[model samples]
Target chain A: MTKVSIHVTLKEGVLDPQGKAIENSLNTLGYDGVHDVRVGKLIEMFIDHDDVEAQVKVMCDKLLANPVIENFTYEIEEGVAQ
Target chain B: MTKVSIHVTLKEGVLDPQGKAIENSLNTLGYDGVHDVRVGKLIEMFIDHDDVEAQVKVMCDKLLANPVIENFTYEIEEGVAQ
Candidate 1:
């Protein structure tokens, strides 16, 4: 099986309330040097397919990520367990 | 600033309904070769602190990750933007 690691993050210029909140929280917790924070999702999937990259792109575009405001990047590793 | 990428994933044996649902969806969408899926979170933070590793550990322990069912790993890169 091929294991792919996908990271879905908000695109630049989009409003990120969750990330903003976390940044504030970190600063409040005495991490005074914190400049910013961005939170996103990481998806790892094991597939038995041959065209791993193509399949992953389809998965990300269809459901794993919101293309309107989010961008995704993935890496594929062969013969790995989930 | 220092940028950190943190990945928090569920530990083995913990239930992963979201991952399961995504796996089912992928199969239904004709990705029949998909074997399994695991969903997690990716957090990127930019900090001006010198001791980045220590600060990140505190952030994960206190707010960024759930220690009971999730495990976290982080990589710190110097002089990077958010």
Candidate 2:
């Protein structure tokens, strides 16, 4: 099996209200050093196939991420036991 | 500045409807080899503090993640330019 992990993050100059809310909450909780908090999605999956990278890219483009507003990067580990 | 990234994922045995939905979507989209799709959160932030790891741990425990159902891990890079 192949293990794939994808990180999907908002592109620069895009607004992230959820991240802003977390930053505010952190400051209110006295973690004042926290700043510019941005939140994204992490998708992990197992695939029993070859050409894992290309397949994962297609998955990200088709359903996992919005290419217009988000960017995605993935790491693939092969030969993992099922 | 310090750059910290936190990955919050649902603990084993926790129900993940979002992941199930994504898995179903991928199967429907003809990605048959894909399985065990899990969705999580990735939080990236900058902190101007010395004890970044400790501070981030507290943040995770306090507001960033629910200890009851989720587990979190973080990576910190020091001396990042603001």
Candidate 3:
């Protein structure tokens, strides 16, 4: 099996209320240097080895990420399943 | 400015309903080899450069992640702000 790690993030210009809230919370906690916090998704999965890249891309396009507002990038680690 | 990317994932043995749901969805969509799906958060932010690693660790401990059930790792890129 192979391991696929995908990062799905909001596109530029999209509003991220969650990130803003975190930033505010961090500042309130005295971590004042924090700014422009953007929150995204990290999905890791195990799959049988076969066209790993293409299969993962289709998975992202179909269900893992919403193309209208988010962008996704994935890295496949061959034979790294435990 | 420095760019920090943090990946927060559930600790092993923790129940991840979201990930299970995604896995089920993928199977229903005919991606049968997929399994062991885990969903986590990827947080990206910019910070003023000064003890970045320490500051980020504090932020993670204080607000960004819950150490009880999740584990987080971060990578720092220097001078990557736009």
Best by DockQ: 2
lDDT of 2 by residue, A1-82 (tens): 8989999999998999999999999999888999999999999999977788889989999999999999999988777776
Q: List per-prediction Cα lDDT, in the order shown.
A: 0.88, 0.93, 0.93
> Where in model 2 is the C-alpha error above 4 Å?
none
Q: Which rank order by DockQ, best down to worst?
A: 2, 3, 1
- What lDDT is reached at residue B49 by model 3? 53
**lDDT of model 1 at position B70:** 96
Q: Could you give the fnat of all candidates in order?
A: 0.89, 0.90, 0.86
Q: Residue by residue across B1-82, what tens digits does model 2's lDDT show?
A: 8999999999998989999999999999899999999999999999988888889888899899999999999999878897
For candidate 3, write residues B15-81 as lDDT tens digits.
9999999999999999999999999999999998579999989888988889999999999998994
Error of 3 at B39 (Å): 0.3
Task: Please compute DockQ, using alpha carbons, for every candidate against the native two-chain complex.
Answer: 0.84, 0.93, 0.86
lDDT of 1 by residue, A1-82 (tens): 8888999999988988998998898888888788768889999878887788888898899989999999999998877854
- lDDT value, residue B39 of candidate 3: 98
Reference A-B contact fraction recovered by candidate 2: 0.90
Clashing pairs in 2: none
Q: Weakest 10 consecutive residues, lDDT, candidate 3 chain B?
A: B73-82
CAPRI band for model 3: high
TM-score of each: 0.94, 0.98, 0.97
The sequence of per-residue lDDT tens digits that candidate 1 reaches over residues B1-82 is: 8989999999988989999999898888888898768899899878787688998899899988999999999999877754
